[model samples]
Target: MVVLVQKLLGHFVRSEAYCLVNGKDLPRLDINSPAIWKASVEVGADTEAAMSNWEPAEKRAFRLGARNFYLKATGYLLARLPFQNMTLRSLRCLSPNAREEESSGSELRCLDMKLPQVIQPGDISMLMDEYTVFQLDTLESAENIDECWRAAFDLKKCDGTTKYPILSKLVKAVLIIPHGNADVERGFSENRRLLQDRARLTLESFNGIRHVVCYGERFDSDPSSFTVTPEVLKVVRNSKKRYSERLALQKEQSAKRPREEPEAVPNSEGQDLQKEVETAKKMLTNAELLIAHGLKTNDLAEVESGNSLLASGKSRLEMAIQKMAGSKNSLPANDLSVHF
Candidate 1:
């Protein structure tokens, strides 16, 4: 009974027809109603033939029972189901095969009405054009939801610019909406197992473990069933080199930290400080690339190493900034000393 009502509500929310739930058409699950039951079930040739044998009192009882059931079902749904706002109903426009008549300019215009910050009024025309092109050109053979959006995104205009930029943005925003709270639930489960008494792990290390577990699960459930490809072997081999580089970078940066804050520096030292800053920037860029690669490959260890390297580079950069600040502060003093 609950499931049936939920399905009906889902249909109502997704329905393109405005004012569907209003007036006499509101959903009511009165399965016990004698007329409805007779219509739904296998019966004699005619409606009169089907219920002719029932006593008048029995018929009245059945009608009363159906009324009570309808009230109960309505109450249950009212308590459980979320109130459907117009914006949620507007999502039908995002559907791959949503017709032009169904998703007209007026309907699309209403999307930004509730949330002006997200969907601007000016974006409506471009979004409409993109959606039309998506329907006509891209949606014909698209096998899946993602594919339908991807094809629309790849469509090009006459001048070679992207054909559906606004549509693509809309699709991306919709795609990121979590289908359920499964991931959040799983995170809590993972935390419970990892955070047992005395099993202390740094935040970075804990995250690395979670990533590895997630990566493993994506392949196969059993650890032994995991297949290590050549690419995996390559990453493993370079892991030591990456770790060494991180350590060296950290050591170098630490060594360069001003022990006793230098108040002044000569022109040569100022030039050297600028050079160090440039070098730190380059190192930071490399570290960022390393982190990107790790994320692309789902390698948490590599990501952690990259993070360490990035921190080291940031420290080096700060040191260079300090030197520059001190140089500027003592410039007048240096000039006066040179004159004496």
Candidate 2:
């Protein structure tokens, strides 16, 4: 039974391409082959019918079909399945030809005309341990019929390691490509400019801006006539209402608070009074000292004038006094002797 199954599986795996090209259904190899036919009959009419429809050529076709089906199914299933106990060694047993093709890829060159190179088992194992192990394992095991397969596998593994799971899933499931938030942020920037322009716009006009900015699609026949939606207007109105309410609350609270007159600070009267008293005391002491010394007001005036003397004018004053004395001498000794 195992031998038959193995033979069937082998035939299907080998002729997958032929089956797809011909668009023929798979034929049952075990149906007519007495050993498996009895088991098919025991299973039911559907099984029997399926088995009876089997032709040897169709069997080949079915094997081919099965191979094609397995290729796609395994690729998808492996995407979700765990990769425990999975390695190049186990994968080699499942797909010997795939292993050989990967290892001996000198014939198949890349776009750069360089021979395809295989990654080291250690590297592959490390990648598996770090990222989506099952995905990498499946990809490594899957037949590399095209460059896209390797590219997709490598991208998935790399993305899994670098990005958060939710983001990675979004990349795979939604965009089907890895992209940063920069794209979304750019959309927001463009939308904001359109929505908050100097020219007043309705909600519909804003929606138009959003669509054009985010999706890069024109909304109306006349692009100028594009507009936003009611939903956007509702959001804007709610935000404005909330802001106004907050402002009103602040104003009310301010109004409710008690008003108080500003208090006046005293001038420096104490310092002024002290300074005046000291000036009075100094004048009285000066008067008493003048009386005690019998120094007249004229003497006091002379002392004040002397205190006002300039160093530069002192020589000129001395010269003027000498000149006066010389003029008196010039009057003659006889006129001077007559004077008292």
Backbone clashes under 3 angstroms, per model: 0, 10
- Tens digits of per-residue lDDT for model 1, 1-340: 3345544333223233223444223334333334332222222256437567999887666655644655465557655654455555566565555644555444555664543445577887777776666556624565466776677677788999988777677667656653456854555555446433212233344454555566678677687877767755555446545656767988999899878776665557656766566666665665677578777754544565456656666777777677777774432223221110
lDDT, each prediction: 0.56, 0.36
Clashing pairs in 1: none
**Top candidate when judged by lDDT against the true structure:** 1
Candidate 1 stretches with Cα past 4 Å from truth are 1-55, 97-173, 176-215, 221-340
Q: How accurate is candidate 1 locally (lDDT)?
A: 0.56
TM-score list, all predictions: 0.37, 0.19
